[model samples]
Target: MFKDRTEAGRLLAERLKKYRNDPGIVLAVPRGGVPLAYFVAKELGYPIELILTKKIGHPTNKEYAIGAANLSDYFIIHPGAVSEDYIQQELFVIRTRLKEMYKKFMGNKTPENIAGKTVIIIDDGMATGNTMLGTLNLIRQGQPGKIIIGVPVSSKEAVEMLSKEVNEVVVLLSPEAFYGVGAFYEDFKQISDEEVIFYLSQLQKPS
Candidate 1:
């Protein structure tokens, strides 16, 4: 098991040393991804950005994600019978909250240009990877030079699924016996929004 997110980020950075000084940007899936992506951006001397994507839960079952929204645009609905009205309401609420979050997390900073630049999307880990996939769909529309997925650990099934969508997948561990993302980390505490702000404050702008 890894010590924490920082340690995992350092280890992942070692493998990604080749990308240092390259025209690549690190996009992190906040709240948990901020710390890990902080280390990567520091190591690679790249600017860090946030991918503000969230899963849209079903009306009947809040835990069940019927779809996901990316940066207040682009919604990917699951291939199932979900009420259009429910989806619309969820989209409006989710997008409104996301804009608030983006303002809090980013301040006045605009999103980095992904067009023609290598984009390395990082997270602490992935469970179902639905959130990441949703973010990927948004990223693809920007026409980046390449899209890479980076995570400390993930389920074997998630890795296989993500590999097909992204140009490259960089994972430290992909164990078949995965129960959940937190199971692989020794100190998998819930990341606070304040902690996310702290990490974002520490990011160095690309030179």
Candidate 2:
């Protein structure tokens, strides 16, 4: 078990030492991932950017992710699982919210180009990995030189599912019993938007 997200981030940064100062970008999954990514990005000497993607939940079961979408692209695991109308509607709503989030966190700054550069995606943990699969599809559109997933803890199934899609999966813990992500942490408090902004701002400061 981790003392908290800070400890997890430091440990993850150590594991990623080989990539220190590599020409790459560190993408955080927002909120929870920002803290971890801050440490990792600082250690690796890479810029930190948010990967703004949200899951398109199944109609009946909103908790079950049918796909994931960003502003420019989307990917559905089960093509015929949902109707085109529903997908379009979700696209509008999700993109609208994403635009707002981007504006809030990034203001008018242009997003960094990831093409031909190593892309390391970081999150606090992974559960089912469906959302992450969708995220991978979106990231591929950028044609990064490599794709890596870094997480503090994850279920065995999640690691297995995600490993196939990315060049590498760096996970600190994968317990066989497989409890939820928060279970592995002594303090897993929900990260707030202000905290996210705080971390991002710190990265923007002159070193």
Candidate 3:
């Protein structure tokens, strides 16, 4: 496992320095993504901001993501995991929770203004690929000139799936025996909504 998220980000940023002066923006999938994106943004000289989205949890187990939501008021439900009837039944609840989470986690951030820009979506890592997929659908709405998915590490399947979703996918590792995203990181603390907002508000302050 990597020493920590920062170290992993440093390694990933090296691979992304080609975009240092290129026309691009970094959209982080918080709250874990915030840290990784922060370091990468600093390295590559790009603006970083949170891309708001939420997991559409299973009807019975909220921990399990059946799909996810995008900022355009759209949800990406996993076609293989749940039936159409089941997803249709839970659509309303999913949308409601997603909006609530957007407000709670994203604060006053606006996801617009990315029209025709090259947007790079950053996450600490990917496990199921649902989160990255959901966030990608949202980013695609802005009609970016280019779209890239950057992660420190990911499962082989996640990397493969994400590769098809964006113009470019940059991952440090695609371990075959990956059990989860945290498996690749030594420090995998649970990031809270408050922590996400705090980092944004604190780091953005004028020096």
Best model number under lDDT: 2
Residue 121 displacement (Å), model 3: 1.2
Misplaced by over 4 Å in model 2 are: none
Indicate whether candidate 1 or candidate 3 has the larger lDDT: 1
Q: What local lDDT does model 1 show for residue 111?
A: 84
Better of 1 and 2 by TM-score: 2
Q: Write the per-residue lDDT of candidate 1 for residues 69-171, one digit (tens) a residue.
A: 8654666556556777777888888889889998988888878888998899999998888777777887888899989899999988888888999888899
lDDT of 3 by residue, 1-207 (tens): 788877887888888888887777888877788877877777777777777667777868977776666534556556667667776656666667667877786566665477777788888888878767766776677788889888988888888888887888998888879888888878899878777777666546675
RMSD of each: 1.9, 0.7, 2.9
lDDT of 2 by residue, 1-207 (tens): 999999999999999878875689999998899999999999998999999999999999988999999999999999998999999999999999999999999998899999998899999999999999999999999999999999999999999988999899999999999879999999999999999999999999997
TM-scores for all predictions: 0.93, 0.98, 0.81
Model 3: what TM-score? 0.81
Task: Flag clash pairs in model 2.
Answer: none
Ranking 1 against 3 by TM-score, winner:
1
